[model samples]
Target: MKTCFIVCPIGNEGSETRKNSDTVLKHIIQPVCQELHFQVIRVDQIYGTDRIDNTIYEHLKTADLIIADMSEYNPNAFYEIGYRHALGKPLIPIMKEGTDIPFDLASLRTITYATDNLDKASAAKERLAETINSFDFSIEQNEKENEPVHQNITPYLLKIQDEIEDLKGIMLKRNDEFAKQTVELAIEQIQKNTAAPENKFAEILMKEIANDPKKFKEFDAIFKNLS
Candidate 1:
């Protein structure tokens, strides 16, 4: 069966936002997916494993379809969505009305609803169901053929790690123990930050560093949260 991965911030216990998220899953997304024969997958639904683990990359890469909730402006959701977009797959962006849609993604279609308004939620659900029914998967499958399929996520991340090390090596020489920083410690911090408690900016910043090691100003900007 096809899988529909729900990418949203799992709220703390008893939080109103989480309660609202559960409502969307139960009344809006779940029923629609059930009728469409898609197995609904959510981070909270995973049992006996660290929910905040890097395995989220697996869901982003492999899910047949993805629905990302933009409410609360969750950074991890956006980060995971970025990888999904890079994979060239089908994604449905949804949000509660009044939530900010980032300018970069403003051009794409999105479903918006007033989470507190039952009528609006119901209408949004109906439209989303139709959208799911009419979705075209052929384009996504064609793109997926060009992307490498990884059975293990570690090796794929190791490639990123190598890039990180290469970037750090250059930085280390320029400031040999500048501020008493070492490449090993820097990588350890990056990996630890990326893995747990879900600090999305660190993950993105690390990727930016790996992508362009020579850009000191760029790293400075990320450090200052300027970009």
Candidate 2:
């Protein structure tokens, strides 16, 4: 199933920031994403022992789509948005009306709504759904035109580029599966009543390694050697 990673400002519980974010999630983002069959993953909703930053990066790399809330000029939200942009992935940026978006993203398309106004929020949700719908249309268009053409060398290079992207996606999915299995096994061991303190430390170490691709690769190599 396709996933939509949400990059938004999640403040302390009961705070105004959290309340506003929750309102947007419940009233706007979640419903639209669900209708489109996109499994939404929010940072706060993620449980378990994984390092949050690493998990964010993993999702940023792999999620089929991204929805970013630009309210409050939140640095973390913008940072994640930037990271997704850097990856050259699709991201839908949304904001509350009157929120000052940073100069860099000022020119990008942003869906704005008034949190306190029902009509405006509903309209925003419609626009958001349309934007996401376009993604499916674009993918279909790409697929239709994916036939090899004998036109020029440029087409050949483009083919190579597409192949590279496909390979990268496959590698990312496999890595996620491997990481998930490793984490599950480690959790099972850690939950054992007789597990030692050293096992607890190992669990922490595993979480760190799982977060960093380079570290994870090194760990994988060592594990293979031991096996």
Which pairs clash inside model 2? none
Residue-pair clashes, model 2:
0
Taken over the whole model, the C-alpha lDDT of each candidate is 0.69, 0.70
Query: What does candidate 1's lDDT look like per residue over 122-152, in tens digits?
Result: 8778767766765554433644456743222
Clashes of each: 0, 0
Which ten-residue region of model 2 has the weakest summed lDDT? 148-157
Instruction: Report the lDDT tens digits of candidate 2 across residue range 1-227.
Output: 67999998889999998998888888898899899888999989999798989999989877888899988878888889987776555677888898876788754567788878989888888878867765542342121223421212222222233333433454456675554454445444544634542465367557777687577775576457436
Cα lDDT over the full model 1? 0.69
Model 1 CA lDDT for position 176: 39
